[model samples]
Target: MGGSEKHAGLNNTKLTERLETAFPLLFASIGCIYLSVKIFNPHLKNKTKACIVIPTVDDLILFASHRAQIAQYRELEITVAGLAEASLFTSQKFYLNQNSHINKNLYTTVISFGDTKWNTQQKSKTSLRKYKINDERATHNYSIITKILKPRYKIVKETRNQKGKIKNPEYSYISIPISKELFCDNLTNGKPFYTDFYKLAVPNRDKSGKLKYRIKFEQKELNEMIEKINFDYEAEKIFIKACHTAWKHRLGKLGSDSKKPGASSFDKLVARDFERLRVALSKSKNFESFRETITDFWSRAGRIQELTDGWEKVMILLEPENWKRGRDLALLALVSYKPKNEKEETALKKLEFDDTKGEEDE
Candidate 1:
């Protein structure tokens, strides 16, 4: 009996030891599962709510064109935050308006102006100096978005180089992960073809080939290009539109005339009168025919030809009737490619000089 009692005690001790060893592992496994669920839950939710980040007005237009791509997904909600004024001109504005199928109930929130790289630098009083601390406004802006937006998704590229150079002197492409914050006590200033959000969100590549995001406007270059042009861009755009309108009217009139229904023998005899009227009208000095002829002539002209060729083409399209097309085309083409400055001559030489294959190869 004594030996049996000792054996029973030993068995109980072994059972207790085994249970104690198993308890920690069991608790650890449960904790891991809990953490996994927390992480994955947000990811699953994001599959439904898409976040969109546009840095400029131009990008907003691009987003509009692609609005249809995401329209079908029922759970999709886009969060658009960028240079606010630019966004107003883009597709987001249109979507926010009545024309789109996007859900209106989805929330829209505004971020402050100083938060944007463009605005921060623009607001800064200091002239940009290399290797100096970035404009305080710019750094402050970055902190604001990082704190307020709390976006699970990110589409921006850091502005600083690996060596800490502020390449564009505006924009921050680099990113750091953040959660909802008391955050920093200090204020800060701060094009791929793929259809998927991931691919579409990829920003324009920089000279070094890394992705970059920021507004880099060469206002001087654009102004020079426009100044050198003899004619106005606005006028040219209007003229092209006018040509299209005239062409449309011509097609409509001709098509309607051709679609007359069956009629009497007398009607057939009288059709010659209609034919004569049509022929006279066709031969008249109409805008459509003029546009066609001018464009056709220009089309056959060599690609190496300058804006003068394009102008001449427009003239050919409009001319031979009233000569109006010819005059307009010539006037428009006159200043199209005029060099803006003496420096432009050197630039052109570099651009037009292609040195890849030598004369020996030729």
Candidate 2:
């Protein structure tokens, strides 16, 4: 019925009659075909003919095809919502189920539709806006998916007004994928492990529902982290361990006072430590020197004993060739939250920090 004029030109009387006969049965099956009609207008009305058409066996295939297409259309909407919500696990599952044979180069298309105010009398007056985002990879890695879904903004250049400040500073939405490898990597884990990292790095809004800190990694740094991860078991383990250590240092029993630090303070500390470690790793010529730097860093936070427990594995990760990986792992560790159970909480509490050193030392 919605076909173009070209397709309508090809229609014959017999086919048209067949479609006319089938339409009523299709509408009735969906409860859209009304049996009774009444007139509300206070005017003399003429009698109308009620035409009821019965569908044949030939129409069943067409109906089934239409239903399948409708289902797929609805599924596309659900998939788009899943991407926005950062529900990669569910999205991937749905994607896999929908595609019988997975394509290696499949990408998601996300279209955000907006419109200006519409006039009640004139519908054509409205200005429609469409922001299409179609580059996001159709994959199942939390790290990659979170990066894609995370809100990003770029400054729009403007001239300064008479005053020193710009009259209006504007920002535009932007998407920068971490790496091409992330898009191509089929070996990456799709688990929700990155949730803890996001939770630690991006804290909840304050009582005023405003963000107090803006701590986020650069695209280059994120790319390095992804490259280091490489979907390798050892690398993932190291990254997770680093996250655990960071959690213990920042939010565990290592704080300067009884009061918990603000989110801003915590994020700043994590960022600072990450930079310090990155510099140290670059400067270190051998494992021994890097190990000493690591020891010194943890000693300041009263985590020397904890470092000792994992010395062997940590030492292997600190080798010269693996310096970048080590630095990225350190960043991951410093920015991830590892939720602790009662026993783990108790253990953290028992670990003592050096009371002599102030928070400034850390």
Candidate 3:
């Protein structure tokens, strides 16, 4: 189903499915509004020693999920030297709300690369002649179509090759020439952080010299490409996310029918997210009472299994006095806690094999 109309029709039983479908749109809208307000700031730019490393597109969800946790610690601004449109958009939106106090503009210490790369790949491949996006007056165009058309002014090629050098330093708060290599060394050794990025942006032609989005690499090749993106990445400046997919379990190696994501890997990922929440909440003034509520929970609600159940059990468990609004705390415990020496882990591994192999042999 689509939006509200479909949502209104669904019974309580299918609400979870509806939410899973709608999560992306909801996050995008929230993200857009957050970024839109960063324009009219009057304060001096923040020149803190910081960097945010986003290895891939999928990792954006994690950042969106824990944006509040990240905002609490607004560190230095690590210059994103090479700015493609999508990367620029994602970075600006992702890092826009780092500070709680937004009376001034603090995050404008940019190592500016013009929109040439993005513009060059476009149909018209032209930037506006009179109005160049080379100053603080420039606002990021959210719409992809509007950014491309140079209607008011003529388009021209960029005059300079400012790849390894900083351009427009006078306007910059903290201008530092950064290379793709420094953040993640893989790019220097022919292992770029954005493996599929170039192919999508500047595509290759077919045998007939027709533009088609079809580049088939081996499964092993894809694995290597993704692995290379983080080679020698300093986690301090470089944000590393765990592999989004269960890379090991694919269609061929596991079976004709692809196996489900490795259960252990997924559980461990959830454990990490929960652990981060624990650290954040521990500093709150309410933590003492919240701790007492958790202690009380063990006596009142069932074990970790009860905590792991859906919103129903969660609602019941947190409904008591002193635990009414501690759903976040309960969630942390739920994901982190597993039964002692989980039998399911070993049992699944033991059963892992090519189910189709037996049938093919017969």
Candidate 4:
């Protein structure tokens, strides 16, 4: 009798423990049912903001993975928008190819501008409003949303100008904020796009080939690859470092380091080339003599209308003088149209001598 009682007590205790462990789960299941009914039944309205994200198709897929927890929130609704033209990769076709881990039932809308197709499109005027706002303020709010939601993978820079003006510069830098727990394993591996052992096992091309390099994956292969690329914090950090290095090389410096002289970058070479043109123009005597020559030619005998018609060409022929300002010479030349003979040239020379002689007498 004592043994029987002891065994019965042990069994009861185990049963109670199991029920206790399962109670929370049971309650959660009921709550989930209630929420689902409320969401689709048109009876319960969404209490939270309807998240409208504009993302290219590929980025939308990547963002969806990080949003698994958010999707679980019954109150939240996720909408992905894209433009048809700009977003070549992000489309219904591409999305269909990739199995979504977050909000599998999410909706995608493509916005078209004129005849052009865009990658992401949103019905809400929120983005338009943002663009109308002061750029700095708009970018700041956008960045905050991105950090919290990590939706569209847009980068916003908080920058200061030479005059100490603070501004937020927008960028298309791809970044996703993922939960630490979900990403930890991959984060240690330093590959954001590696999702599977097979993807890791795939051979990479070491040299150039006539055909482009591509990794062909079906549904099963894609599933594995997506998992491999999901990066954790450490992996993100490494990727960021690499991005920073590349950005530095591409856009960090404008010209050669000022400390190093005679070492020219592309920008420096361009500046030097422009300077040479300026010097050549400055030294050209054609410009200096332009006005005087035009005036003298007019005084001699040139048609004013003809001179006006061929002003530019005449100026070029009259070199040095074209550089001088005003159309005084050009005008006179055009008005005076008589062909100069040797006698006329001699008379003009004599008249010039007589004027000098008169000045001497004075």
Candidate 5:
């Protein structure tokens, strides 16, 4: 047999040269620090070669365009020092400057190394950090980058019966991406709702020392709501107001206290209201029936006057065809947390007292 010819592998030096040639703008913007720290350091330790995979020509073009677009934003800056300080090359944490323009496309490139999922066995070794961004101008795009992680089971082995049918399957823990829109919603009182949504939806350990999730949602539902809002400006406005209304009502129930509601209480409120809306929509045969259900819900919640005055538009969004979107929006609104203002506090105080008096009279 003829001997097979061995080809030389592309080492970090060659890879760096190739990257610098193909993506000059990216190379210049991130500088040698990113290339040395993020791309090559791990290879030196593990004796493994790391390479950027441009899956298609279209992807390469898109990435080049994104890098070019990011270069244009003079105000948009990433601190290479900060990246090193955070150990972002090895860690999952990525930091950006506060009050900076966060181009979504730019973010995809910067955090490209962070995988959406990892083996459950590696959970303890993984560290995720939260950094604050204070740009109201970039709220919409900022929300789009916040991720939601979901736990999934992967089949590793299957036991077959004598008949050649599978009897028992062994599964292993893995993480998967659910959606990005979990935190992609309107700001509350001019502040981003990303932190609040993270507390509510993301899985965390509880007092019992076990991982728990307050609520769960599907990607399709959030995508539907996002699509509707993005296409129709009026629908976007209505959705925002609906979210605000739900937050107001939730805070109002707190009775003017400075104390914030805990995640469990918040989850309970969202679940109760979501179930009510879901059931109501599922049973309604037409627009009129849906309207009646909404009217009844609002009336029972003591928001009849608000419904009559301004919520007609919100009602329009809950029609038969848009019921699912409406339900998802309501779910988002109920779970979303916003800081209470002085005016809202005073109103809540009055509402609480009025309700107490009504109960006494009854």
Candidate 6:
């Protein structure tokens, strides 16, 4: 269906480190903090907080094999991202030609991996197996989703690496995002939308062949059923780790280590980050002082935003001059915005005039 590709709450990595460290900080003081925000923030007010994660190796396996389960949840649009994985092999020209025949959306994207110093390390014996690249199923699915959603596929590797033992966490890092409109309305020729996934009540007949009043469904009602979530920097990492852990948990729960998504795995992921951060300082003996606050941030990953918005907020709270500047910058987001039409422009001008007058009076 042709509509919109509204994406939000995206956090992807494009970072570098000069020296090797055991653990990475959100704002690694080791190297000057390379903080950049590009068209992403999960701060949509008065909406439910939830992440719509799609990429994970195990998920790709189930998605490819479990045709029945997929059909069961077809209405949820959870599998719309599956389209990304499936289209990996097709060519853009082939997709265009094929879609011309059927009313389907498809696009071909070539698979290529650019080698960076960080993601690769020299080893004496072992084949240069990529660290984050999982089984073939996962690799395939990742290709598909990245093509469709267009999220930043981040892989920040250390500037230097161990000669024999290269740390390969890059393969584990998959920043998953899929288009919302790609999963929503006009799909399947108005068959069923994500808004129609859960049935509140199945229509029933009262012992007669007559009919009962039908409760009509409205597409607008699904607006609040959001796809993205609001999370601070610390929370973002913790959230991603939690999701991966849940998926790796035994889906069957049949064996000891069989994986599935659930609350138990979520708890373990949080606890793991807590202890890891405490020991993260041990990466470098001298940097302990700098790592302390960041360690505390991860310890209370659940309450990061509740405590502070970003590092800027943390600095503002600790200083006087910074606080004044922070207040001025806060007003910038309020005062700076583009209006779509003259009606909005006039309203904005009046508000600006009133704001200027109030500021002068102050």
Highest-TM-score candidate: 2
TM-score, per-candidate, Cα-based: 0.17, 0.35, 0.18, 0.16, 0.34, 0.17
lDDT of 6 by residue, 1-362 (tens): 00111122225633444444425343222211111111111222112112121222223333344433333442223222222222321211122222233113322221212223342421111111112211233222233333434423456774436575565543423333322222222122222122222121122222453222111121112212212222223432232333222222211122222245543442343333322432232222233332353344334334344334344434432243323222222121112223334533343333211222121210
**What are the per-residue Cα lDDT tens digits for candidate 5 across 130-232?**
3233433434333333222222344588889999888987765332232322232222123332323322333334455444333443433343344333323
lDDT of each: 0.29, 0.37, 0.29, 0.28, 0.36, 0.27
Provide the lDDT at 93 for model 3: 45
- Give per-residue CA lDDT, model 4, range 1-362, as digits (tens): 12333356344453233677666555432221111101111111122112222332335445455344444643222221122111111222223333422223333332222111231222122211010111222222222222332223455777888987887665653322222111222222232222222221122332342221122212222323223332233323232222223222322232334236666654444334323322232223455444454354244332344444444444443444323222222221111212134432232222111222121210
Could you report the Cα RMSD, in angstroms, for every candidate shown? 26.8, 17.9, 24.8, 31.0, 16.7, 28.8
Best by lDDT: 2
Deviation in Å, model 1, residue 207 alpha carbon:
40
Q: Tell me the spans in candidate 5 whose CA falls farther than 4 Å from its real position.
A: 1-231, 246-297, 304-306, 309-312, 341-362
Q: Per-residue lDDT of 177-222 in model 1, one digit per residue for the tens?
A: 2111111111111110000111111123445644332111212332
Clashing pairs in 6: 84-144, 132-171, 132-172, 249-259, 249-260, 250-258, 250-259, 250-260, 251-259, 251-260
Compute the lDDT of residue 163 as modeled in candidate 1.
Answer: 92
Model 4 worst lDDT window (10 residues):
33-42
Off by over 4 Å in 6: 1-80, 83-95, 98-148, 156-172, 178-362
Candidate 6 TM-score versus the reference = 0.17
Clashing residue pair totals per candidate (backbone < 3 A): 26, 2, 7, 40, 0, 10
* Candidate numbers sorted by TM-score from highest down: 2, 5, 3, 1, 6, 4
